[model samples]
Target chain A: MSRRLAAALRPAAAIGCALAAMAIALALLGASPLAVAADLADGAFGNWIAFTDTLARATPLVFCGLAVAVAFHGALWNIGADGQLVVGALAAGALGPALAGAPHTLAIVAIIGAGGLAGALWGGLAGWLRARRNVNEVISTIMLNFIAAQLLSWAVHGPLMEPSGAFPASRKIAAAARLHLYFAPTRLNLAMLFAVALAAVCELGLFRTVPGFELRALGRNRRASAFFGLPIARLTVGAMALSGALAGCGGAVQISAITHRLYETISPGWGYEAIAVALVARLSPLGVVPAALLFGALDNGSQAMQRADGVPAQLVYVVQALVIIVMLAFDAAAGGGWRELLEGGAPDRPDATAETCDA
Target chain B: MLEAFAASTIAMATPLLLAALGELIVERAGVINIGIEGAMLAGAFAGVAVAHATGATLAGVAAAIGGGVAINAIFAFVAVNLAVNQVVAGTAIDLLAAGVTGMLYQRIYGATGRAFTVAPMRPIALGPLARLPLIGRALFDQSALVYLAFALVPAIAWTIGRSRFGLSLRAAGERPEAADALGLGVYRLRWIALLASGALSGLGGAYLTLAYADTFVEGISAGRGYVALAVVIVGRWNAWGVAAASLMFGAAIALQFVLQAAATAIPYQLFLALPYLLTVAVLALMGGQADAPSALGEPYIRA
Candidate 1:
């Protein structure tokens, strides 16, 4: 029990230090750090509507975070989730207009399926390169992001372009295909419920299945897993494809729930931002929920920080950097100092191990 | 028509070649510097900002080198000493550089204004080499940076293949433990390689601001650094091969521009997507089971 308490406290202490350091930096930059923090709190939770907005913003983040966490657990770095999300949104957008006369339920299903398939295909390509050709997924995924961006730009500017054609975005999806809002006067829609359900499913799949065990084994040591007769190549590809599917679903949810249209910049690096979420969550499915919500709040409140205190929106990114650095630092220090702590009449081994695993 | 294509292709390929060559060297020495994008961005901003400030093109070029190296040093500390994941560290640096440069630009020049421009580097006549008809303009009549990019290909190839220092560097990358056992310093070689890569990548960034666009803009590197990374893979990790691959991509990009200029029925945006599309296609086809350095992404800690 004491060990568990220490494990929880260690991360909290590290985070506290990180927050204090960021506050100092913000103050040094001539911004009222306290005011910015206050604004963030107010914007995120000062009212019921504001809190709903935070939840709405967190919807896509939840999907992307889980997508990243899934692949990361398999030791596959699917960095192209951003590109996958865009492609997914593009496909869903196209499907919505084409199937406008279809039955409502059918139209929604088609749009979601189309988006997932698009993301899966994009992600599968990276897996194919990694498994068959030994191309680094990191390089391939980054390259694919540029390709996806260009494809969206072309689509919005050409074939699927809105009639006005002044901006690079597609026409709004049919009303029948849009996700219904569960809460009136807020952007919160069925997507949040879907995200929560998906998170629950992912948690089960990861912790309770044979495939999950294989994936965890692969992540821990591919060579050893292979020696134990796991099909490493197929697993890597499968994991990446599934990861992409989730990210694509994220895009579909965004289009149906909020945007209602396919814009060229559908995601403002939401897929990339998912990396931070997954990392902060230590790639745990259960952990991703709170991490995504926290990040969503930070992102949503950043504008308020800028408006209320003249703090640059870029300061959020600085905080994210500091968070990652501090997390890693704390994990390392805790692990290294564990032996000393144990000798000094404190139980530290389990806590140190947990912290290392989180990292 | 072919002559025009070839000329523009060479012009387009110059920056990629410079950047890819730098990345190839650093990767060859075992440090996967994902911060190439950040380095390039820094160099691009510094190059343009200095030229705008000093009005001397040379000063701008020098400042770009300084900027690139400065960014790279930060990455080296995080990745080398702190043992942070290289990809994460690199991404952070890229984000930091993007945000910082964007803010600095806005602070200095204000939001609503056209960026300052610099005089582009003029092509040098190679005297006898300039007399050749079709090939001359394609190869000889190019900026100093263009020629330097081409020259570095063979120079890097020779140095990596033959030099004593190159052997030590390769040893460090291939098997750091073995290299350490043999009394070679793994850290030092990686540091030197990163610095050299910074200079070359910085030059690549300078090419954009000083030659291509002749002005600064947000995200102006426009994923070129990442493209250079693909170029290294498509080039099969060889310096000469990297040069050839860069030229191919350059030609692809130049063709898109030409098609746009000619106002073809096909959307110009599709044309813009061609290079990236080709990069993926090339990787799919050619990147087959090639062996990377043993310690490519792992940081060495003395245990």
Candidate 2:
């Protein structure tokens, strides 16, 4: 088989394995696996509304997945995307009211810009620590995620709390600041459009731009990159910041378009799941699109599975975990297609020796 | 006030110390086991389920150890044998634990009202030590796990730093190829380290449900496992350092309780962030990458 076809088949085979495992699990629960599968399919793609909602749900994942994918290409672990996302949501929510008096375009732009900047700062902090201080990004990012959670709760409950004091959430943004709802009843909005556009941008930035080449070069061999005069520290920080900006964009889109206001819980661990999404996509920016949608469908379908089949909604988390494991197995079995995928299949792969384990 | 804080700090530190010490061993054996969290969660679930079912805390703790071992065995298979991405595999283990535990809790307990609550393990007071002043009483009077956790520090420190096995374990992590060339059986050494760490991590988890909280809450392990990860870093991967760092984090938790009770103006979330903030702050101060094991996250293959 062609390497590309084998690469594509790897994920498909992994998905099949994951489904079989879930089927066995369902049997243990005394539920019909076939019925659960049918219900899940129905919930995710049964009708136009379900499909649209699935796409709507996929929007945030697309952005976050791309964020993770881009960072992973440079051999960076940006687990703080979740924290960055929350800060994005918080920034947009806090700024929404202040921008009500401005023109619609300016108000929207400012909210998005503020959100992106907040995310960038958060991501940049970890990147800076990794670059300058030699701190491990994984641990720092995880700690930052905890701090971000507290910050979100503090804001929701203390500062930007609703006027009525009945709920732990900020007041809904001014109607004008909210993104236009497209294909009503499905929560589809302009944010999905932006996510798609950004995915394209990420593709160009990673493969076409000079900075992208340097970043990829750094990822391939830091020793060589440094010897060749690449600014290793600066590129690391920039890639991380840009990665955070994308995730922050996700948080902004989610709050502005779907939630319409910041709440105590804005995401159901999309940032964590985005790791699986990006990894499964082999760190391909374009590949992240379908992978995100697959996750969205799993999430959307889990709700249906719960409603129609008496299964616990937490089943989706199980499937997600299984997917990551299965994908890793497949990638390993393929003798490191993961590295090739991340390096975007260049003719001269500089990172042939790079192991997927670090990621 | 100081005495009360000191006593609570010991309580909070036991679990963190156990997990960190366990992670220390795992990292020393060439595997950065992120799945320590998952193993701890499994132990937590097993401890609560068995204790609640059989009405024996000791039995529950044993089962928890077994559960932790089982989870780590899977980790060994993937990380040591298949040589998959350790972070992704570890994360998958965590998610699997969360989902399985949550679903089982819901199915068995029915997602409503108070779930089954086991009797919290009573602290055992050492004869004369219990009668002593503030420091003595707090230190000597504690659950068996607390004592085990503290005692393990020297035991672990010696086993890792002085023993022949210790040299081999470090050799495996530092340079697996060299270790293998010397006929040390790198995979075998790593598996042993993983199993040992799993048992310790499990003991920590059981301490939470059977001794600390005395009940199971969904995701009750919470961020403690991850906090233990930070503690490993803050501890500089040393046993005594782990104890000190864990105590510091324990103090952070105790301070949160004291602060929350002292005022209504300050949001409780600020205190919640204390340990995490401390972790980041410590990492910032430490400078970086000088202390990490060379082959810490690599999956060793007999290349």
Candidate 3:
């Protein structure tokens, strides 16, 4: 088989296996897998409204998937994108209402920019720890995630609580800060388009730029990258900050277009879910769009499945997890190819030996 | 009030100690299972569901172990057999556990889940020791699981610090290739560590429902599993150190309830975020993996 065809088939096969396993689980639960599958398909793509809702659901995922891909490419294990997104939304939500007197376009830019900046700081903190303090990014990011969640909980209940204090939510942003829906009665908006544009930019930046090359090289072999004087610390911090900014912007867009206000739960684990998306796309920047859309459809459809078949919406999470597991297993079993790319060259490889010698 | 705080601290520390002990074993064998959280969640759900069905807490505890082992088994296959990235594999396991537990919980108990309570395990008082002043009941008069958690500290310390099996396990973690050369089966050692960790994590989860909360809730494990991971680190990869760190974190958590009840002007969220913030702060100060096993987090495939 052609390598390109093999590359394409691997993810498809993994998804197929994951769905099959879920089918067995559904059977055990006494729900007919076929019926559940049909319901999910119908709910996700049945009508124009459903399709638009899927798009809206996918918008944050696209941003998050990109964030994950960018960080992973630099071999930075950033598990705190969810926290970064939350802080970003908080920033946007806090600044949004104050932009009432500003021009509409300016208000939108400021809100998103604020979100991106906040996300960068959140992500940069982890990066700085890893670079300067030699702390594990995985642990720090996870801790940060818990901290960000508490911060959001505090914000909604305390400082950002709606004026009426009826709910644990912030006041809606000013009208000028909102991203206008392109079609009435549909959630279709410029945010999805912006997400797509960002994916294109990411694709270009990762493939066609010197910094991108440095990041990829760093990811492929950290010891070798350092030996080659690749400015390891700076690249690590920069990649993590950029990754956080992507997720943060996604949070900002969600506020601008969908929620319009901050709440205790601004993201439904989009940062974590994006890990599956990034993996399925094999960490390709451009591939994140379609991958996010697929997961988005699952999210949207699962609601309908719940209503029709008594299946819980959390079934999607199970599928997402399975996809990642199966993908990793398949790539590893296949030997070489994408596994090397994904793991950034295993230690036993020749390059690793060279790195050891250098050390 | 002071006695209550101490009691609460011990009770809270029990679960963290159990979970951290398991992680200590796994990390000592050269693998980090982020899925420890997932295992705990699986255990919590299984424990409550089984106990509720059979009206037997022991049965629930057994099921919790099985549930935890099952989740870790998937992680073991991917991270160990496939020789893939342990962190990513562990993350997937966590997601799987969360998804399966949440979906099944809703399916079995309904959306509102108002009927999901179980009779908590009765604390076992150590005869006359239970009546000795404030600290007595706080430490001695506790559930069998709580006592078991503390007892394992020395047991684990001796096993890892002095036993031949521990030497092999540490060998696997420190340098798998060298360990393999020395006739130690790195794969077997790592698998054993992961399985042991699974059981410990599951027991921790069971303690939440069967001994402490007396009910099951989605994400009741919260970030306890992750915190357990930090416990292993802050403990500096020593069993006794893990025990102390767990108690410190447990006290941090117990303080939340105490402070929240005091109703100070402080926002309750500040208290809620305390343990997590403390984890980051301590880790930052500790800095460097100077004491970490040499080959930790690396996938080793025999040549």
Best by lDDT: 3
Using TM-score, rank the candidates from best to worst: 3, 2, 1
Q: What ranking emerges by lDDT with the best candidate at the front?
A: 3, 2, 1
lDDT of 3 by residue, A1-359 (tens): 98778878998999999999999999999999999999999899999999999999999999999999999888787888899999999999999888898999999999999999999999999989888777888899999999999998998999989999999999999999999998979999999889989999999998899999999988878877877788877998999899999999999999999999998888899999999999998989889999999999999999999999989888998999999999999888887765665665321111232455467
> What does the TM-score come to for chain B in model 2?
0.97
lDDT of 2 by residue, B1-303 (tens): 777777888988888888889999998787877788888998998988899989998899999999889889988888788777676678788888888888877777775525578988889999998878778756988999999999999999999999999999999988999999999999999999999988988998998899999998888777788889878778877899989999999999888877888886888998889888988888789765446677777777787
Cα-lDDT of candidate 1: 0.79
DockQ values of all predictions: 0.28, 0.51, 0.56
Residue B155 CA displacement from its true place in model 3, Å: 0.8
i-RMSD values for every candidate model: 9.5, 5.7, 3.7
For TM-score, candidate 1 versus 2, the one ahead is 2
Q: Which regions in candidate 3 have their CA more than 4 angstroms from the true location?
A: A344-359
Q: Compare candidates 1 and 2 on DockQ and give the better one.
A: 2
Candidate no. 3 TM-score: 0.97
Q: Estimate candidate 2's alpha-carbon lDDT, on a 0 to 1 scale.
A: 0.84
Tell me the tens digit of each residue's lDDT in model 1 across A1-359. Answer: 57657655664665577579878977776777778799988888888888989998888899889988888787676778998888889899888777777888888888888888999998988887787766778778888888889888888888898989788888889988998887788887778888889898889998899998888777666655656778777887888888898999999888887888888778888887787787677677877888889888988888777778756666666566656556555554455422221112110001122233445
Clashes of 2: 0
Over the stretch A55-92, how does candidate 2's per-residue lDDT look in tens digits?
Answer: 88899899889888888777776777889899989999
- For all predicted structures, in order, the TM-scores are 0.90, 0.95, 0.97
